[model samples]
Target: MPSAPSERPLFLDPNLNIIFSVTLLAVLGVSSIAPVFPTVARELGVSPEAVGLLITVFTMPGILLTPFFGILADRFGRKKVLVPALLLFSLAGSSCSLARDFEVLLLLRFLQGVGAASLGSLNATLIGDLFTGRRRTEAMGYNASVLSIGTAVYPSLGGALAALGWYVPFALPIVGLAVAFAVLFRLDSVEVEPGNGLGRYLRDALAGMKNRKVIGLYLVSVMTFIVLYGAYTTFIPLHLSERFGSTAFAIGLIMSVGSLSTAITASGLRYLARHTTSERLITYAFALYGVSFAAIPMLPGHWLVALPVALFGVAQGMNYPVVMSLLAGLAPTEHRAIFMSANGMVLRVGQTLGPLIMAAVFAWGGMARVFHVAAGICIAMFLSLPLLIGRK
Candidate 1:
């Protein structure tokens, strides 16, 4: 089903440059702010548990809005949905720097989340549009690698900015505006056929979901984020801070270590894809997640903990691109946006619930227990996948 490669090298492809930019900007939502959570909690007079709401509220809107945005993209055209969403994301997200109160900051983050709801799904949708076979895999690997770069840099950038003031990191979303301008003026629109009708489109898309394998992928997506947001992104910084009194800059550096490893693994995904099935790679990813997570809470010091974090990076780098490429391959061309958007919706469900549920775990058992519990969940998921998704 895959098409032949373009004459131009992937790096020279302008369309891909735009997609990579989108991927880079998309990660700014969480990674840029996470290292600052402890600082926020201390400065704003809230418990660390309450600060977790920052992640929760930002992800909540995507759960409800992504499907509709997908439908709109499928109907009107991708740019029609993407440009406005980028504008909204930039305008609302950057405004957070002005908020003095926690409630006000949450409200701003919710609005920014609305803009973000479609970005990830659309980013993947465009890949499905342009490339196929090994080309698509290479593109997915590069896109994910860019995402890894964003994740790796933003925390350190954020932590460094947080040193200036707690609110300074919030101002960084302003860069989204520049990315939005590039997307609007430079990124060529992918052609989209207007569907038969909204009702008919919904029917066909729903029919695609009836496939058990597709459903299994969605379920896998949910569990993957639960462990990621709950254990890695949401709490690990807190764990470092509370246990070792690590500074925001120090926490960011430790967090970036994992992301750096992820970028390295993702850059090599094409070779990995040739050697093994995506399903097997994903299985191995969860295994790495369990091993890394179980080890993190037991490590004796902050800097030493980077060892396990690097292992978790391998899991993350393997998990995201493989799952996305498989999903893109499975989705029908006509309904790909909605199908990918549905993936986005479930991802939000995982992201939203991850911190809230983990917050409960943190409240009950404290920070160290959170990683131990998440480790158990990853192992359970690794075991359960064979049953839910029959071997390809």
Candidate 2:
């Protein structure tokens, strides 16, 4: 049971507030600036592709560093890794405002990605530590709900601030610093067993992932984000502007529709899980994604664009927490941090690949084709789900 509170807001007893709030704010480093890339390109006298690297550079390092961060969390304790990572995230994120050159900004973004790495893998580790069974399912739902809300809130906040100036959005990271301070004071360190040497850790990681069910979950992690981030970090804003003459605010608001829908879906996942298995939930979610992306280009107007985007959000909301919760079940507690961190690394790989691959597709056949290709990939994955998941 989560500890009961005596005086502080009740969630403080379990650090749920700290977990939810910090994880929510932790992601602004990515979500806040995505909509502002066009304006940043203009201000920096760089191509939109160069500006897109702001997203990519920040995310790319998460792929490489997540395992190291995972090992650190397991060895040093989650809070020990978390506190300093939060500080780096705060500093690097805020430092983006000071960057006069695109290269320098990319450097800062890469460093920020490294910091961002811990919040994800470790938070999942912490969740696995704190809750179990239905409670863990419920907690993962709340975690997804917070993520969905952040996805909804940050882009709009960044867009509004970006309208003031490209530099203005950079100030938002200071708020993350405040959240970091809260976490520093509030979150307790989880005690962990002594870690085996790297060879053993690697052996254990391979052993767990060798399970076909776990392998499928990791593959789902890669493919799902490829479609979603491919859309989110790159073309959708530009497409909206071309079709609707959208300002940053309009783009952010339209984007928020999908995330808001995700929030609603995630908050209700406990109930959803009651009726279905995670495997089926994930398959259905991907099908929804395939259909939604295929439909995005067919949108006749700004409002109609949201119809497909909302469906994508539902897919993500239903899919992500279930996948993570399922992964927690599959992994041993002793090595959970590293296992989940590997999951985090694959997520970064997908996030980076999504935009780069979609860019190539957009170049060849434009936005419609991008969605078409994304649709095809999702459908292919959906069709192969049974084989990929195999026997548990």
Candidate 3:
């Protein structure tokens, strides 16, 4: 059995408040740029189709690198990898503000994605390291809430900055990363058990892959990103531009409304944490997410559209923490980072595929149909929830 929070000494406690704050900032940094993708593409002289590659660019490196980073974190220490990774995230984010061409921007964005992957997986592992049982569940719920809040705020904030110039959105990460670095420095490092180097790390990762529950959770994570991000990254801006003749500022406002829903619902998610198991909540959350996306195409205009986005935000905020908490629970204590990294790799695969799929849909049927397809994908994922939730 896991130790209770009261029994764990405060000094060595994983200060969830600080950890969550950093996570919020990190997510905010990434999401702020999401709403501004169309504008950035226009400014850089790229097509929306080409610009969609931004998501892929950001996701690919992390997908490729996270397993290694995860193993390193498991073998070395979470703090050792997390702190430096934050520094790298900050630096790359700043460089994004200075990119002179699409190529440079793409390269920098990939590097930034790598940093984000490291931070995201490490944060979950850290939570796993610090808390257990009910406290762990509660922490996971709160983490989900913070992620929603960040998602809620960042796009509008990014949109607001994008009004000044394209680079403004890129600069947001510097501020977020700086804060993350400060928080990371104050945390004490956790000790890791010694391992048999590369061979053992690979073996453990493969073992994690073989676990049905873990694989299901990871697939859910991937599909969640693909559907949520695929739509958000591709259609939201287009929808704004089409329906409202939205400027960057206007787009920010619309996306911010969605974020507001996420932020608001996040506060209450901990209550659900107290009442429900992670498995059950995730199944329900994904079902709600599908329903929410299905509603998007039905909403006729920008003013009414916020309702769907807000609902989606609520589902998203509820889903992630539970999924993450469950992932942490399933992973071996000694290989937490590697397992988390593997999960990230699967998520990136979804991230990579989502945009390409959406772009093709956009080309075939226009923007409105993309949401319909997203709804379909979400429904398929929701159907599989029964298998995942019932697992031991």
Candidate 4:
């Protein structure tokens, strides 16, 4: 007789359950505020250019602080850093709900970014600590899937809340915080050995930076995120608003479709992991993403435009788990957290600069020209795939 699927335990251990909850909450808290940015900016009396700074402020601190947080996770323990980080994130997020001015909101957002960095680096490191080989890959796949779900669901919910008031969206993180607190209380802590001081950490980080394979992965990470996020988050809203007269609700609907695609694909990544090598999957994913970017500017309107964006979402959903799995496999266990943190730092450089670069291109030409330019950069990234594949 075939055993029923429900007979098996959902998690192998209670700790995995706790960790998964923490990860889900952490992602939800960070992403939920994004959909309300347009509404919030209007209420605060800021220009769209200035409102773009919100994205910058949220990510820049992760660029600067993630490395240190990763090291701390290695030296101490993942849970040790993760719990306190979530607490701060929750508090900082609540504080943002109270801000009366753009400057104050930016400051709070920066601190929120710092807390986000700590939570992200440590969460991944903890998974690496708990799982191995195929199990590790599966864990990462599940994590990616949940993260995509948060990204998809939060925007619509945020938009709905924003209809009430801008501050309503900011308060949503408290729900995430409540979930995080539950996980923190239930999870057992893992013990970690002390790491070398700052000097040794710096030496190891520098050594990783010099490795060609590592450098390639870092470049791909930066470029992929810059192109994907820059287009969807920054330009797409503007494009809809300018060309089709999109409102906050309408933009949220478009974003929701992409997020839905990402969530569905991400959920199936574990099955894909069984058939493909991480390097090969990433190469194919990037190629598709590049093609999608190149197609976007060519589309004439929203109905036609969504096809490319949906393709991009599918490519991204497949790509991230593979990229992250490869990175986790490459780093030494002792330094895994720090290595991930460093990768994040590089990604932030891309995140911080991508919008600014897009803004410049938009100024020089316009949105249509800027999309073409972004497509050009993506094509360059696609051409680099052979370099990535050859190394494997």
Choose the strongest candidate by TM-score.
Answer: 1
Worst ten-residue run, lDDT, model 4?
1-10
134: Cα error in model 4, Å: 0.5
Winner by lDDT between candidate 4 and candidate 3? 3
lDDT of 2 by residue, 244-290 (tens): 77788888888898889999999898788778877888888889988
Of the candidates numbered 1 and 3, which has the greater lDDT value?
Answer: 1
Q: For candidate 2, what is the TM-score?
A: 0.94
Query: Against the true structure, what is each candidate's TM-score?
Result: 0.97, 0.94, 0.90, 0.90
Minimal lDDT window, size 10, model 1: 1-10
Q: Name the TM-score of candidate 3.
A: 0.90
Best by lDDT: 1
Candidate 3 lDDT over 1-392, as tens digits, reads 23355765432345776677667755754578777777777788998878878788877777778887887888878777777777777888778899969999988988887777776777777778777776776676667666766776777788878878888788766765655666566664468866777787778678766887887888888988888668865677777777677777677777777666766666577676677766777777777777777787777677677777777877776777667877888787887778878887887888888888888988899887888888888888777788865633
Task: Provide the lDDT at 123 for model 3.
Answer: 75
**lDDT of each structure?**
0.89, 0.81, 0.75, 0.72
Write model 1 residue lDDT over 1-392, tens digit each, in one string: 23347787885678889888888777898999999999889888999889989989989999999999999888888888998888888889899999989999999999999999999999999888877777887888889899998999999999999989988888877778888888888887667778588889899999998888889889989999898888899899999999999999999999999999999999898888788878888888889999999998888889999999999999999989988998999998889999999999999999999999899998899887899899999999889887777656
Per-residue lDDT of model 4, residues 199-270, tens digit only: 886687678767777778888888876875566677776777668766666666667677678777877887
**After superposing candidate 2, which stretches have Cα over 4 Å from the reference?**
1-14, 195-198, 390-392
Off by over 4 Å in 3: 1-14, 180-184, 273-277, 388-392
